[model samples]
Target: MKSLYAATCALALALPAAAAELETYLEFEKAMPPGNLAIGPDGRMFMSVHEFYGPELRVVEVMPDGSTKPYPTEDWARAPQDDADGLNGVLGLRADRDGILWMLDGQGENQTGRIVGWDTKTETLHAIHYIGAPVARPTSFLNDLAVDRDHGAIYISDTGDGQNSAIIVVDLETGRARRVLEGSQYTIPEDTPMVIDGREITLGGNPAKIGINPITVDPTNTWVYFAPMTASAMYRIPTAALLDESLSDADLEAQVERYGDKPISDGSTVDTGGNVYITAMTDNALGVTKPDGSYEVLFQSDDELPWPDGFSIGADGYVYATINELHRSPALNNGEDASKGIYKIVRFKSLADAVSGR
Candidate 1:
């Protein structure tokens, strides 16, 4: 269902003029594209270099002048050959209120998923949790994650095809993990074609179909929201119900709520007023879903936001997003990378104040 604001915005997109333009925060000229970003309380910007393109570095810190450097250390940014503990492939990252940066490593083709938390305040390791086997299957592409500090847990979206897709719950206190809602209707991708510019993106010669990719926790940590990259609706479940190991699959599914409708999206974040900001990838725009299930387009770009991927709200009350042109990647472009020069990290004002790292 289209909200009233969305209905009006849909009509606005029909006009030739631009709706809103994003402010350029950082630009990547010769570097690999960024996957996700997290802004610290002190204003430090950290981003994960997308692993889909086989980047040399896993993570980097965006300096004041837009230059990039290995985050924390060169060694940590570049994993030693055959070293599983090193930062292998990070995409989803967030900053806790305590200024601790949490990075989620899907481990690339290795499939050794792990979560690494770095204490920016003290320049130390806060925690490291490994996810494997029963919880992370061979086909699991651990995409994005949400840190529920209030519940002492982390919820990850396992976009393992559309059949085995599930939301993984990891206990922050004990590092135990369990896969819930595996292959449920809520977690699986809809039979929607991911078309960009009139051409459907293909992965391995077939139409790219991703399931339950964008995931985020609300400002109050009350609910974990997520959706399939090919689905049109956002779904959420209470943090309490997710943390309750006693709940069966059906019980967990019963608590799940279809929050609102959204376009094909990649990443998301929320503000203090329960507004969820999501990257409207198909439209090359940014949008938000309000507390009352109303969704509105905040901005739509003409040429700038080509495949806006991840979102992070900074302490300055701006929403930062990565534009990587993923549909042009080799995997999606029929074995030929069609991305042009310069990826970007852009920021726009949020409708409401937001938690620094989400």
Candidate 2:
């Protein structure tokens, strides 16, 4: 039998490269604009169909022939009515080394949120944890997440519509969760407008400002790196402090440190070498935040990458991202959906080997 690494390498070669540095892994029609994405241990790619398009299938598995099928099951992708495992609306998802896919359901302007884990290897439910009330408020938008199996915890970025943003830490063992750094400068958005393609993005006739949206953890799971979507700097906090229930909010705030400068980005993922690849939303590029707090662009294209929203490392030693034209959505385009061209999923080789699903 072939090894896992060898299998990944073989599958990667099936797709022809589109550019010198990037490969167009998949493309979709106008209706299936993708949100966040994850690749399983066996190279099966999954993504949440962008909620802005009001899709019937919320989560789907991208097939080898560029088609999509309801992930896990058709019922699980529909509205959460009778089936408890149904995904209401998912924006973020990640697959771990153990073959479990963890999906974050923000519930789309609803008051409650949830995290569901399914064991891909066994095709069975692994765990489900509800997040609401004290930890998540009515305005909470659970944008993205990072799984730290070493600490038995999952860190989420609650981009509370630019007002009450914070980091929510959930204990995998107890299912208890809490919000930290609430209303802090590091989590709230700066007074800046998001301008893409020479036009400022607006929602309801006002600038669409978002708080902490891009969040990721290093290969070792020692530090959590994050930043506000409208801000120009990245920050980090030790994972130990986030899981400690004894620490007060003030103590936790003290542990936060500015890691480096970053562009206005949407999602990020790290490699084994501590290099964080960030999606530069405004610049239409992907840049890396180095270990020494320096930044450089790895790839850029005006036509190919519009709003690069999510990031996930695959077993093939490549980082995958979704290029959805979110800025053209009705919410950001003043009540008119102006999006054109095919929604694309692209991949490029990572600078170093990565822990898949981070």
Candidate 3:
């Protein structure tokens, strides 16, 4: 028998240096681009197509044989491009151990936010709730989310779409959402210009402030970890403290701990052993952090992983992510859809274990 730490070490040694070459898992037509990756318990992979604009297929499940079908239903994905209800579509997804597919949705036009849960096992729409008003303001990006099943709560990060940032906590059982750490350093973005492939990333002719993009919870569900796209360090807070709305803003801020210095990351996930896997935006690779808060490069990024946007651990222990090719989009490239290549979904050997609180 082997210990979890020893297994992780052996798996790391099995990976190649300078980053192992990644294989293309799936490709999408330009009309329907990729958003995020979510692997379910049975090895079924789900992806959220770009939100809003009422995409033909907003949420599609990637079959093991290399085909895709609209998840739940196509009608369920008809996100109103004009702002009737922003919650109609999904931009992020996570399949929990309970066999439920949780989706993170936002109205790009109005910055409205919503979360929906679909019971994959029973094939039923489980729950749906909207994030409105104070918690989710007009500028909220509602970028990503992570579930804490222990207390029946879900934490959402508002990227501020460049203007601000905050974490929105919702009680799944009660349908109550609370805004925490608003405008704090943890949620604020430096908007540092990112240079990938010698091309500076610019959106709307200015540096993009994609704050609080990635959020993940640890195995015991004790801490909820998070980071901004333009970031210096990843932060974590006690899950119990985050759920207590009675805590003052100052008190909650005090609970935040600088887990460690990290690179600009778009997505992050944690294995059961407490190893944190994050997208290495600077070197275009996969980076991991130990439980002690030490960081190291796992695999260098390449191919369809140009912009690794979302991450999830598969049932087989592989880490999966999506190649958004975001920097080339017309929305950021002055209306010129300059995607260097085709969009795709990719995965790599995480070597650790499945995500926490799953």
Error of model 3, residue 100, in angstroms: 1.8
lDDT (CA) per prediction = 0.83, 0.85, 0.75
Query: Candidate 3: where are CA atoms >4 Å away?
Result: 1-21, 29-32, 52-55, 80-87, 108-111, 161-163, 301-304, 353-358
What lDDT does model 1 reach?
A: 0.83
Give the poorly placed runs of model 2, Cα more than 4 Å off.
1-20, 82-85, 108-111, 353-358
Better of 1 and 3 by lDDT: 1
Point out the higher-scoring one by TM-score: 1 or 3.
1
Candidate 2 versus the native: TM-score? Answer: 0.90
Q: Residues 1-358, candidate 1: write the lDDT tens digits.
A: 5698897686445322222556888789746698899988899989999877778899998888989998867878877566533687888998888788999978546547889999988878889888898888888888889988888899999999789999999999999999999999999989988888888877878788889899999878998998888888888889999988899888989999989888888899887767788888888888887677878887777488788999998877778899998888777787777788549888876665422222
* Candidate 1 error regions (>4 Å): 1-21, 108-111, 354-358
Candidate 2 structure quality by residue, lDDT tens digits, 1-358: 5698888786444322311378888899888999999888899888998887777888898998999989878778877775465788899998887888999988455437989898889878899888988888878889899999998899999998688999999999999999999999899999988899999888668787889999998878899999999998889999998988899988998999888888899999988877788999799888888777888787888898998889998877888999998888876777778899559998887765432322
Residue 59 lDDT, candidate 1, scale 0-100: 91
Residue 176's C-alpha lDDT in candidate 1? 95
- Among residues 3 or more apart in sequence or in different chains, the pairs in candidate 2 whose N, CA or C atoms overlap within 3 Å are none
**Stretch of 10 with least lDDT, candidate 3:** 349-358
